[model samples]
Every structure is written in structure tokens, then in C-alpha cells.
Target: MNNNVYDCAIIGGGVGGLTLAIQLAGAGRTVILFEKEQYPFHKVCGEYVSMESYDFLERVGMPLSAMDIPIINEVKISSVNGNSFTRKLDLGGFGISRYTLDSTLADIAKNKGVTLLQETKVTGILFEKNLFLISAAQDIYQAKIAIGAYGKRSVVDKIINQRRVKHVSSEKNYVAIKYHVKVELPPNRIELHNFDNGYCGISKVDGGNYCLCYLTKSKNLRDNNNDIKKMEQNVLMKNPFLKKYFTEAVFLYEQPLTISQITFNKRSAVEDHILMLGDSAGSIVPLCGNGMSMAMHASLKAFQLIEQYLDENISRQNLEVLYHNKWNSLFSKRIKTNEYIQYLFGRKLLTNTVIAILKRVPFVTDILINNTHGSKF
Candidate 1:
């Protein structure tokens, strides 16, 4: 192993890690990023970023127009019974596929002088005397500080045996399926269609395609013989709107991508010398449509706190306190609100009632949209 050390080591090359690498490299820090996957890979994501991330993207010198993705200014919510409501979102969001999004940021990081080790996974991190020894498969890297953007369900999370609060209920364990489909969905609109056991979203993406994604209770799929196509045909087809799309939409990709058994209860933000960001930190409910934007925003927070600690201006305890406080202030309430929304959607009666009420109260819809998506950064 070489005895060289970097100023910062980022463990995941997703949106959060790549964004921080670009930011820190621009600030003249010697940083290294380890990603287990190659560029232009698809992540099981909603593929929508809120307006709140516009300023951050601009700061990173990523031109919005250059993305070639569709812009959505309105949102439509529908129920299993075909009842629907439309609302004009106060702030717009963008749709770019993860393949393009990740590659673009990776290119920006490369151009900004951040060392990126693609197809490399960080096995473990050893903390000692204000430095970290990060272990990959056959290589080791030393760094003064580490950021764990390694994402959800990483082996590192298990290795740390991270503490889990008691409130992590079984109801939160779910699965997500996504597909790139060529359809006639409006470029400036996004649809959230709710079925019996869960909901699915559809919107236009960068490559003139539509991202059709859904998060459903795993038990529902299991009860249907573990067949995705059968589950869609029998359960999802019950919803007329989704039935129409599933029957009519031409899938652009060969098959739908799926991530199973996602747990969204909660986890520690900082543990064992690693700071989590994005989904690594905590994931918001998908219906809010702010997951990617939240990930990007969290990168800025993680960068600030890590940079301060690395500069030796703040004690580790104080740094953790500040980071936790900032994270809670920015996202805790929003997450809780989304969780409540998810619960409401789980019940068909409540979902329809809430949509009917919100349709009548335009101001309430505005507030809901604002809370779901914060003001632009």
C-alpha cells in the first residue's frame, strides 16, 4: 500500500458524492472518489429533481439546458377508483435519467481534478488518530476525513452494526420498480397514480423517454406469486389509469429495473468515522418527488461540515452536533410530512378524500406543493 494520503475520501460516486467531489476539488482540495459501478449506469430512482436544486447545479457549472431533459410544472394525482385531481406546482422540477445525470457529474468531477476510481468498492474504513484508512478490494487509501455516500443497503452499513431506533416498522419495508418507457406523457407534467397496495409515478426524462416507477409493499408482490408482470396485470391493472398506460406504453428499455426490500424508517447520519449523505443519510417517501434534489442538497451540507472539520477549526463532537442539527432543520420535518402523506395514500378512502379536499382548497394545494418541494435554492 502506498503511504500517500488524500484530504478527503468519498466512498460512493452517486449524485451526492460526485457533487461534493466537484465542489471540493474546485476549492483546491485533494480528493479521491471510489465508485463500485462504471459511469452511465441506471439507478432505481424517480429521475426527477426539484427546482430547489437549480442553484446547486448552476454552482457546479452544469448547464440546465445542456441536460436536454423535460421540465415539469404541473402534477396530477389519481386514485385506484379513477378519481383524479390536478395542481399547478408553485415550483417546477426537471427529469433527467440517472444514466445521463451520473455521467455528467462524473465528467464534471474529472474535469475539476478529483481522482475517481471507477468500478472500485470501499470494503471498510479504519479510523485512528484523526485519519482514516479506507480499504478497497486490493488497494488501501488514507484520508484525513471520509464521507459515506455509499447509499442504502451497503455492506459498510452492516459492518458498522449501526444502531436502529425502535420505530423502524415492518410497514416501511418496500420495493421499487422502474422502467424507461416510450409513451405520450406530457413533457411538462408528472403523474402519481395510486393502486391498491402502492403508487407509481410517470414523467418524461432526458432521452425523450418516460420513467415509470413504483414503490409497493413487498408482501403484495409475494402474495401474487413473485411475478412482476402478473402483479402488474392483476393488481396494477385494477387502476384504470395505470392499466391504460401499462397496456399502451411501449417500453424503451428491455425490462423494468427493480430494487427490493427498501427500508425507509431511519438510520444514523454519522457512525464510525463516516458521514452519510443522500439516501445514505435518510430517504424520503417517493411520492414527494424530491429524492434526487434532497440528495444533491445534502451533498452541500456534508461538504460544509466535512470541510470545516478537516480544516481543524472545529472539534469532532461539535462538528457532529452541527451536522445533525443542520440535517434535522433542513429535512426532518419534510420527511415526516412525506411519511404522513405516504400513510394517507396507503388507505384508498383517505387518498381520495385528501385529493378531493385539496382540489377544492387551492391554497392548501399550494402549501402541500411548497412543503413537498421547498423554495428553490
Candidate 2:
């Protein structure tokens, strides 16, 4: 048990949590961060980050400009029947693996005086008398504020499940899988291939590796007897582009990293007096290729609000309501737009038609992309 209460305690050491911790600690505020796993682990992410977060990441200690990461400026889309189109991205993005990005950010968080605890799983968070009590393993820690930055889904969600806004449409069960592979792909371009019930994205990341990731309904896996390889061959490989990648790319991992039961349901930005950041608050569909950037952007929003609350500039109630509004203002429209996109791409005929339209009027692709992505923060 720790008797000292920190200024803020962040659950989950993801990009958002790590970035927020860095921000708070850099300003001489006490922060304690918890991560269930040790640093440098892989996550089921697209590995693409939009330009909106480029400057913000640098501000929080990521030297992306000097990192020599791949700058992606073009996009190629292929439908289930192999119909395809290529378009220029209005606001391009960069690629770096979660394995690399999170670890680097974690190192920065530690250096900035954040008490980062690795392999510590927070079992529960309770607000009592205006302070947060965080329980992890056999230890209890205290903080003035608690933040939930634990990605898409977690057991911690059960605590706030009662207060969550139910977005029924976003409740569909989805599975996401990722692999680092050696493939012949253009470094400055990203390719998205849509198949029945799902889509896969591939782009060059750091270390000359390409990240090949996909998200699909869980039923797709069950239809193939819950065998990943069978699902790839029977469902995903139906698309010509995906077939080529499957047959040609040298998969670096023996087994792909995967996450299941992913949902895009609208979650309250503030629940039980604990501020929710990043995917915990709400996640955009993976097909949009902007989730990583959105998560980081939310962190900046949260840091500013948290800073004000810590300085006694705002009441706790005000902080909660303001964060909820700011988060929705920043990302609600984008999430809704991406949800519609995910719907279109998940259907075979609709996907093929959209690709045909995009092929003829390439600017439409730019408009759609701009809608899903945001300006630099």
C-alpha cells in the first residue's frame, strides 16, 4: 500500500496514457502510470498515424522527424472482386509499430519523473471523498485523479459498464489481427483491400517491415472453424490483392497478434469521475487508418483539462463535463463518418461500387479521407 497520493494516476500505458503522463510529469506534476505488460510489446494496430498527430507527438518527446519513419502519402483500395483504385492523400501520415512507439514513449514518461509500473494490472478504481483509490495486485495506490487510457476493451470496463452510453450499432463483435511481414510494398503508400465482412490494410513501418492488419466480424472466423489460416484462405484471400500478399509476403511472426470483441460503441469520456482517454472513450473503425493519431490527440485534450483541474482552475464536475464535450467535439463526427465507411466496405457490392466511384472521381477519396482525419494538433 502506498500512502502518498499522486496528482494523477493513469491506467494503461498506451500512447494516450504515456503521452498524458509525460505531459503531466514534464510540468512537475506527480503521475503514476500502470501497464499490465512490460514495454516494447506488439499490439493489434494498423501502425499508421495521420499527420494531425505528428507535431503533437514531437511535443511529447517523440522525435518522429528524426526517426526516418515511412511517410505515406498515397492510398490504394481494392474491393472484394479485385476492383481497385489509387488516390492521393490530402493529409498523409507516417508509420511506426506500437512495439516501437509505446516503448519509446514509456521511456520518456519514466525520464520525466512519472512512476511507471510495468506488469501491474489495475484491478479497480474507486472515487471516494474526491480522491481515486487504485487497486492493483496486492497493493493500493492513491491519486487525486484517475484516467482510463486502456485501449479498446478491458476488464476495467465492467466498472463503468452501467454508466456507458449504449451505442447498439457499435456492439457488433469484431476481431482484429496483425502481423509484421517482409513484403514488396511501396514505402510511401498504403493499401487497403476489402473482402466480405472485413478489410485489411498494409503499409511500411519502421525497420523495413510492413504491417499487415485486418478486422472482420467474429462470425467470419467461426464460419471457417475458428482457424485463422482457414479464415485467411477461405475469406480474406478471396480478394486478389489480399491473395497476393498472403502468398508472397514473408510473415515475420509465427503467430499473428490478435484482439477480439472490438467495438466502436460510444463510451462516455468521463465515467464514475474517471476521465476516459483514447479508445477507452471511443474508437474509430480501423479502416479509417487514423485511430493512433486520434488516441494521441485525445491525450493532448485530456492533458490540458487535467492541468487546469490540478491547478484548481476548474471544479471536478466542470472537468468531467468539459472533457466529455471536448472529446465529442473533436472525434464524434469522425467516428460516425468512419462507421459509415466501415459499413460500406464491409459489404461486397457496396464496396465494389464505392471503388468504381472513387476510381472515376479521385477527389471523392480525398474528401472522405479528410473527413476521417483531422488537422494537426
Candidate 3:
């Protein structure tokens, strides 16, 4: 096999990786990106990009308005007990299906001169004196900088022996199932309905369809014979609000896409020669409702450090240290905050109380939203 070399090689062509490739290529660096999957594939994601991601999307030369998806301006939270609170979202977020968003970003990366290797799965990384070798299933490539934008799980993480926390029993070990459904829900609103053991969210996506998804502890579904339909009917339908939607809503896609056994524990940013980004670095609780923005934001941080090192403005050791420090400084507090909020949401009573308080002092809701989701970038 031919050994091709580039200034930077990115594993995983997810949002973070694609964004970084575009940014780096735009800045006059040669970047090659590998993705195991082809474009327009659906992943189990909320498909909502907060207002914070608008600027980044524009900077990357992707048109948000061109997508023709809904723009949501309000967030509504409801309890299983029927107490509800409505907060005008501090900053409106955009909704586009991952099928569209991912393809759009990939197109932008290609247009910006990023070498994209589709259907390529990276098998391992080899570290050496001045360059790192990246081995894919079929070929090998080398680069001065290697980025782990691989999203969630990859062989690079294991090769580096990155830190891992012992799994602890928690209510957060839930399954998320998302569906594209045809519904008459408001185009500018996102709804969150709480149930006995979990919560479900419904919002408009691009292409005039709604994304209905839920997260529930695995045990709840297991007790129901691991039947998703049965669990939705028995447990989810128990919520009055969800019952109305599920009964009336028409599923647009064939079947729901699911991600099982999701964990939100801490992870190190720098591992071996690869710098982790997006969910691979660390994920915030889904309740925060802004992981999309976080992933895009991480690409910006990764690009800054990478640009400096590639330009010989900093030493490799210092770049790794600085990347880790910056990653922790900017995101550690937010992750911890989300963890605390997740605990509160895990308990039904705390969630009700928090919603009540937010309803009483509406501004508190805005503050909470701003804190949970950083200012628009």
C-alpha cells in the first residue's frame, strides 16, 4: 500500500472531525479525514443545533437557511404529574435532521479542499519521533498531527489506554430511540415530556417532520420484556401529553434508531498522539440539550491548538498539555454542572420543584438556560 502523508489526519468524519477539517483546510493546511460510514446516514441524535452553532456553521461556509428546517424559539418542559412550564428560549436553536446536517458539513469540507476517505475505518495509530502513522483497514497514512474526532468509540482510544472510570449504577444508563415522524406540532417549539423512568423530547426537524425520541433506564424496558413498543405503550403512554402525541403522531421514518447503554462519565482529552474531540472527549448529560453545539465548539478549540503546533508556534508536548488544560478549563465545569442537573432530573420530585421554581421566577429559567448552554458562538 502507498503511504500518503498530510499535515493532519483526522479519524472519524463526524461533526467535530468534519468541522475541523474544513477549518484547517481553509487556513491553508492539508487535511485528510476518514469515516467508516457514507454520507446521509442517520445517527441517534437530537438533531437540534442551538443558536450557538449558527456562527460556526456560517464560518464553515455552510448555509443554515438553505437547509429549510424549522427554527425553534421556545422550550416547554412538562411533568408526568401535569405541572408544566414554558420558557422563551433565550436564544433560538435550529433543527435539521442529521442526514442533512452531516452531508452538508461533508460537502463543505470537500469544497474547502479536505481529502475525505469515505467507508474507511481506522484500525490503529502508530506514534514515532516526528510523525504519526495512521492505519486504516485497507491502507496507511502518516501525518504531523492526528486528531481523534472519531466520536464516542474508536480503536485509537484503546491503543492509548485512555482513562476510564468504573461503571457505577445510575438512572442515567438509559436507551435513546429517535424517530422521524409526521406530526402537526408547532414548528417553533420543542417539547420535553417527563415519564416514570425517563423523558421524551419532540421537535420539528428539517423536511417537515418531527423527531420524537426518548431516554429511559434500561431496567424499565427490561421489566416489560425488552419490547420497545410495549414499553412505549405501557410506560410512555402513561404520560398524558406523550399519549396524545404517540396516538396521533404518524411516524415518517420506517423504525426508530436506537443507542443503548450510553454513559456520561469523565474522559481524558489528550491520549497518546491523538487529541479527542466531541463526545469522544467527554459528553454532557442529554438534558443539557446542547451536545451538538458542544461538539462544534470543541472543533474550534482543537483547531486553535492544532494550528499553532502545525505552524511551529508551539512544541508538541506543550500543545498536548495546552489542549488538555484548555479542554478542562472550558468544559470541565459545564460537564460537572450537567452531572448535578442530571441527578436532579433523575428524581421526579426534584424535577417538579425545579420546574416550579423556574415558573415562579421566569428569569431564573433564562439564567439556567444560559448557564447550561454557553453564549452563542
lDDT leader: 2
How far does residue 234 in candidate 1 sit from its true spot (Å)? Answer: 1.0
Q: Using TM-score as the measure, which candidate wins?
A: 2
Candidates, ranked, lDDT: 2, 1, 3
TM-score against truth, every candidate = 0.95, 0.97, 0.95
Better of 1 and 2 by TM-score: 2
Per-residue alpha-carbon lDDT of candidate 3 for residues 1-377, written as tens digits (9 for 90 to 100)? 44667999998888889999999999999999999999979988877778888988888988876668788999888776657887788787888888888888999999889999999888878888778888887677889998888766555666765444447585557788999888877899998888777888889988788888787888778889989999999888877888989899898767789988777767878888578888888888777778878888988988998899988999999999998998888788888877776776635777677777767899877776777777666
**lDDT (C-alpha) at residue 244 in model 2:** 94
Candidate 1: tens digits of C-alpha lDDT, residues 10-89: 99998889998998999899999999999979988888889789878978978776667788999988877778888887
Off by over 4 Å in 2: 161-171
In model 3, the clashing pairs are none
> What are the lDDT figures for the candidates, one per model?
0.84, 0.90, 0.82
Better of 1 and 2 by lDDT: 2
TM accuracy, model 2: 0.97
Q: Which ten residues in a row have the lowest lDDT in candidate 1?
A: 161-170
